[model samples]
Target: MRKIFFSGAVLTASLLLGACSSTDSPAPAPSARASHNAADATFAQQMIPHHQQALEMAKMVPSRSSNPKVVDLASRIDRAQDPEIRQMQGWLSAWGVAATSHSMPGGHEMSGDHSMTGMMSDADMKSLDAAKGPEFDRAWLEMMIKHHQGAVEMAKTELAQGADAGAKALAQRIIDAQQAEIAEMQGLLKQG
Candidate 1:
């Protein structure tokens, strides 16, 4: 009787330990996947082309604007935005979404939803393209300031409503960096 009771107690203890260990282990494969939703997708899809336009605008500075400070700011925008575009592209690919599917009639245009805020209309872009020298510098600074403000608003929206951890992190980063750049641009505008 004593031997049987001892064995039974040991077995119970082992089973309890095993159960606790299993519960403490990591989650299964399916639950471990990152969470994302429509907002994250929309943010990525809209931002990619928006960033592309910024790059286009930045590229214009080297050839058209002679101001060293304006050129440096444009270069900074180009460098920062290019990597972010690729990052969002990766996120879209991971989500099985097309990055360019949301464009408007023209290959370069954004959909109607993204047309407001920081986005430059086709005519606005054409005007920027046509500008040169101090005209180009002033126009670029003004447009980019508005663009950065738009980006901050979009990022704030994402931080508030987005489901994905990764997307929210990127949104926060964008808000911080773009806000700083906006302040910098405003200072540059004051000088002109």
Candidate 2:
């Protein structure tokens, strides 16, 4: 009777511990994932393609732009935005949301046609692509300035509406960085 009672006590303790451990293991992950809302999802979905367009524009600078400053700006935009694109994509994946298409019928990445603020039209991209030397430099700067403005607008929207802490933090960073870049680009434009 003593042996049986001791074994039963040990089994009960083991079962309780196992139950607690199993329940606790999955708790934090779902809560973390649940913290995001529809606004957060929208920001990620829209911004991914927006960032992709900026990358496409940035890629044009090396061969077409004669200004060293413009080339450097393009390089910086590429470096900063690529990781952000990936980060946003990761967020979408973690949230179990699919990202919006990066390409549409018009050769632009944005889905909403001209409604997405500051996105270059297909014509605008073609014009920029056709330009070279100083013309290319000026066009790239102007277009990039507009692109950054659009990103700033989206980030502002995210900050206002997003529930996820990480997304809000990223939005703040985007506003700061892009505003500084906008100032720099404006100065460059004035220089030209």
TM-score against native, each model: 0.81, 0.81
Where's the lowest-lDDT run of ten residues in candidate 1?
Answer: 25-34
Global CA lDDT of candidate 1, please?
0.84
lDDT tens string, model 2, 1-192? 999999999999999888778845454655547989999999988888888899999999999888899889889999999999999989988888877645567544564446787788878988998999988888888888998999999999999999999999999999999999999999999999
Clashes of each: 0, 0
- Candidate 1 lDDT over 73-188, as tens digits, reads 88998999999999998888877877766557766657333555698877778899999998988998999988888888888889888998888999999999999999999998
Candidate 1 to native Cα RMSD, angstroms: 4.1
Question: Model 2, 173: alpha-carbon shift in Å?
Answer: 1.0
